[model samples]
Target: MDEAKRVEEGLAGDGQTQLIKEDCQGDLHKKLDRNDGGDRVEDAPEQPMAETAEEQLQVVKQKSKRVATLDAFRGLTIVVMILVDDAGGAYARIDHSPWNGCTLADFVMPFFLFIVGVAIALALKKIPRIKDAIKKIVIRTLKLLFWGILLQGGYSHAPVDLSYGVDMKHIRWCGILQRIALVYFIVALIETLTAKRRPILLEPGHLSIFTAYRWQWMGGFIAFVIYMVTTYALYVPDWSFVAHDQDVPRRYAVKCGMRGHLGPACNAVSYIDRQVWGINHLYSMPVWQRLKACTLSSPNAGPFREDAPTWCLAPFEPEGLLSTISAILSGTIGIHYGHVLIHFKGHSERLKQWVSMGLCLLIIAIILHFTDAIPINKQLYSFSYVCFTAGAAGIVFSAFYIVIDVWGLRMPFLFLEWIGMNAMLVFVMAAQGIFAAFINGWYYKDPQNNLVYWIQKHIFINVWHSERLGTLLYVIFAEIVFWGVVSGVLHKLGIYWKL
Candidate 1:
């Protein structure tokens, strides 16, 4: 994900909720496809027949099982997403880092993407036909992109006409879901290319966890190297950096890269956006404002004099083209976790590998940050930022995996699992202000206007005396409860959103 405005985001799973099916004689059985590499699980418990197909499906699912760990991880990520996105305006840590650094907010999308990678491995692990997998991938990618576009207040805000509706003059092309769609598509494509359908151990013929990890790790490393090289050595900008009338040395450009050149006009990622979409086509919020050069009345006025900042003024999206590259890398890290889950047998071995990967990435991130060779910038999706977020996500999900999957502790997190199962739907609804729409639609004018304001003013603000904390709590409760109820119903009905 990118900046708060272009706003960064997270991923999805392999869609195989119907892994358990009814045999012809009405017996429950888990069908392990020979092509994708799913292990055969015990049959689902028998259920009473229902009159309709939908009801039967619901009944069947009620007795079936799933990878509880994945659901819980996803659930946790979406829960955090709701909390952050709902009241981020009141909390700095929940919104994206202003320009650089990691926050709880930054991990939401990457964690989701990580779940998606794992799900992809799980769902497609048993697919026999690569063509079929490809088809599904294409369809899911399009749907994600569609949701991404719609959430931009595109179709949601009426007219939708060139003249009246969405301000086409500044329609954002890149966004959370759009980036998700692209990342999933690319990652899925990578899976497809590397996938081998040759039978082994009389089981399915699909990309082995071992093979997939190697391909992803190798490709990710190569892509990162190329990304760094182009950004550093080859991106010859028309303008050169100078301070104290001293032109910046090439060594700094090769060493420091984008950190040294934060000008609105500089950086390969922002430059690509300007070239492809121009300023108007990208996101517009807290629009970049360039101050006119002026002499500081006092040298101590700020960290630097008025002349120190870059002069170019244009709001470039954080989730633009190049940052998407880094995002996919985060997803790559997730797929590696996916492999560990699938193939690694020993618990100690699994935990060791998982924590080891996290540590490696963290060490790399620390090195980059301490040396100032690069900064951990979520806005730019810097290498350090990607690695840092991925490492944190891995450790966090690993913990969830232990508690829920291994320990079999389920009751406390069932509500979150419900949210996780329908994560994309919840995010879309929240992002488009659907919760506000319904709540506001049922107007409760109690001195305070909207539902959010009314609830907080009465139940929270009156008690806390802190406007920010109270308002934040109000949003979280309203949105979470609303989505929780909706997802609960959907879950009970055996409905889910998946790609």
Candidate 2:
């Protein structure tokens, strides 16, 4: 008999309804199926079509094991984030961006956002049921937003005041959480509304906004245009109808009119945010204003500004806003590429190589572009910045996909994978005061002493005082120890925090 008929016969002839039911029930199924005279027939074992499909599915699932290459790449990014963030040294040595140029540290956040997009694609593939997929996405997005907001609260270091008269003054409007929330919402909305279909390759449905690739390309284009147009219009008015020399603060003052006078030297964006979204909303702060406070000489700088009433009113900073756009593009680009990977499977190697080489050429072109009109500023997230950094990320990701997935190389350092699994959580812990407090109290002479200072003095200065190598080693060691503790616990508990 055919496979379908055999399956039908087995189902009909089996006195084994209860017997087979009992056999296949619960987690003891394999052992039960092994029992004699249970559901077995006297002839050759019947192969049911349903069983065949299930077995094939199981095989596919097994073959699609988590890509270690991606995990390792993610692990490397997380480790770098910890190192640069925790470094207790001068900003110059830590590879920060120049006023209008990219730096080694510039890649961290975009890498993170890109990985998130990749994971979203992978996750949707794993979810067999649409209802469950939607539920999971919603919950995960909420968790990420919640955690991000909680992290922002760390900087506030005070209770959220909800009283009258600029009670919003103490609350920050834009922050790490705000950015995460925006990205998560946009990506999740796209995935859900499109029913998790590969936008570029899949046939258009009622929900299809556009092909996934098209959407991503459009987003990137729009972001680049908005950044350039808005900055030029506001700052360099000669190029546009808007007035020239409308520095951010002055422009903000003009827009606010009477209300502007009430606030201190907040950025114009902050005032706009307040007008549009209410003062209580996050990101109401101006961007440049915040950066000025953090970096150089501001009226609020030093001891006086530290305790000023409007001390918390720092501007949002350009990099901070531009980073949002970059982040969105990063995810969109990853999603588009993921669709390409899924639909055009066999040509992966060729495609990967092509993308890598193309990106390298693109990077060179961007560098040339930077030499003239567009400087590569991380703060502004200039077009050249996006081109250069995205190109670099593409090359890196291509290498990872090739080595880990294609070559089937196992990770030598399992600990890195562990760290990568709970990357966002690890970042929050380090970014907040958790690890910093512990290190200061346990290792440093003073609780207020920075970790880098301790390493420089004790590990570097005392032990190997003459060498820069000692400091570097100490930095690496400290990061490993911190990540080991964080990732170790996550691994032990089998807790993979996703968002």
Candidate 3:
């Protein structure tokens, strides 16, 4: 239950800033030597005989070991996720990519999984025995699973509805945190089982890349391939990424074929979910009521399918069994990137390696998208979807690393560190509609004069009288900042929620 950092600790530059010289001895060694008649160096030497630069590097590396950039990247993901989740229905673009293609919203979940992978490498790197690592992994996995269930199955609302309220009759068995925990368990087990390390050459001469965990890497490749083959061959009816008007009857629609093929009755993912958890336990999100999705349906009850409690239930879980495979691949890819971070020593090399890997994944993802091998579909957790999102994540993390770690621009992101410090706590609270309840308490509308609306309309909306713009602004100032302040207070008090 590690609190992944949103910003590096103590990054206002008190200490830990030093130029990484190509060789430590070239300039300083000769200048301090009395026998060689070197330049008169008035500097206080670590030893009368220069014997501790490497030693100093090792200690500094260990003591201030965190990469500021990675923490900021992790922080960015956390904050953006919270923002999107609490957006209060402003822009369509802010939402998840419907079925296929990548979007800003879609990137949040994979980035989270990726960070988990990186965190695993950082936390478990120096452990001496597999048994110790297994013990810790089991504890963390169980904690995540338990919390995920509590957040999803146990947590409830006053009324039952899709999108916002919980339906006790149809409580979603799977969820975001549940998916994360499950993926973590799978990847952690893979890393532990394939724990043996062997060096591989990716540099010139004797220089090698990160100590190659070839087995883990191979496992990632195998898992990805399996996902692809299964997606291609094992589709219930067929592999499809088509969008159809959810309101219309199946026969009347000008269909993409894939859509009608993956209809509520025929979709393989939904079938798996139905068989495993039953439709009653599945999430009956009212997408039509909330996001105005043109190409989705609720067979039980909705504007599209007005026949309440009908037999035509089009249920699909974004975090279903099939998609979990892709989630694992997403996390495994992150573990590989973590290895790159650990394996590469020089800052330049680190950036180079990360960028190159990102570009490669993006290229493959695009190629797959065009070829119809695996379109970027989050519902199915398509291979191309994982690739595109993961590639984008790597590039983003690299940029953060460069700006914050390399260039020392760490001030703006300090606030995000607050959210990153106690991310799970904040996430759970937000998910349980705690923030919404707090907002609702004072956010009432009456015939006389509504207070919350007055402030928003007069202050934010009156600019252009565009309620959308005003609403967005109000959300940023009110919800986002409010949560940030709470997390900051908790961080200051050294209170964090883990297992």
Q: Which candidate number would show the highest TM-score if scored against the true structure?
A: 1
Q: Which stretches of candidate 2 lie over 4 Å from their true place?
A: 1-60, 125-138, 154-168, 196-212, 234-323, 347-361, 364-368, 431-433, 438-457, 466-471, 485-493
Reference-based lDDT, each prediction: 0.61, 0.48, 0.59
lDDT of 1 at 239: 37
Q: How far does residue 138 in candidate 3 sit from its true spot (Å)?
A: 1.8
Best by lDDT: 1
Writing each residue's lDDT as its tens digit, candidate 1 over 1-499 gives 0001110123344434333222212432333222222321124555555655446546544543444667667778877877776576566545665555676778876777777676666555444567877897898799888877776635454211112246666577788788888878877777666667412332223334445357776767776876676555545354332222226422112222343354344667666676777656666442223122312322111232444344222355877887787788877777777666556545676787788788888899989978988888766778888888888888887787678767879888887777776776777666456555555555454423566556768888888899788877776676776687787898777676654
lDDT of 2: 0.48
| Ranking 1 against 3 by TM-score, winner | 1
Candidate 2, TM-score vs. the true structure?
0.65
Tens digits of per-residue lDDT for model 2, 1-499: 1111111100011011222233333223242111122112112243332344345333222223344544566677777766665452323345444344555667776666666665555434323345755665566556655665555633433112211233444444445555655665566456655554444244545223234445555655676666555444433111101212236532222222232121233333333444444444443333223234333543122232453333234333432554466567666655554444444434463355338543864666476565666666555455566566666766777776666556766555466666665665566555454554444544345544655555667776578755455655655676666676667687777655444
After superposing candidate 1 on the true structure, give the runs of residues whose Cα lies further than 4 Å from its correct spot: 1-14, 17-65, 153-164, 197-212, 234-265, 286-313, 441-448
For the record, the alpha-carbon RMSD of candidate 1 to the native fold, in angstroms, is 8.6
Residues 434-498, candidate 3: write the lDDT tens digits: 54544444533542244445666788789758977887777677656777788778877877665
Residue pairs with clashing backbones, model 3: none
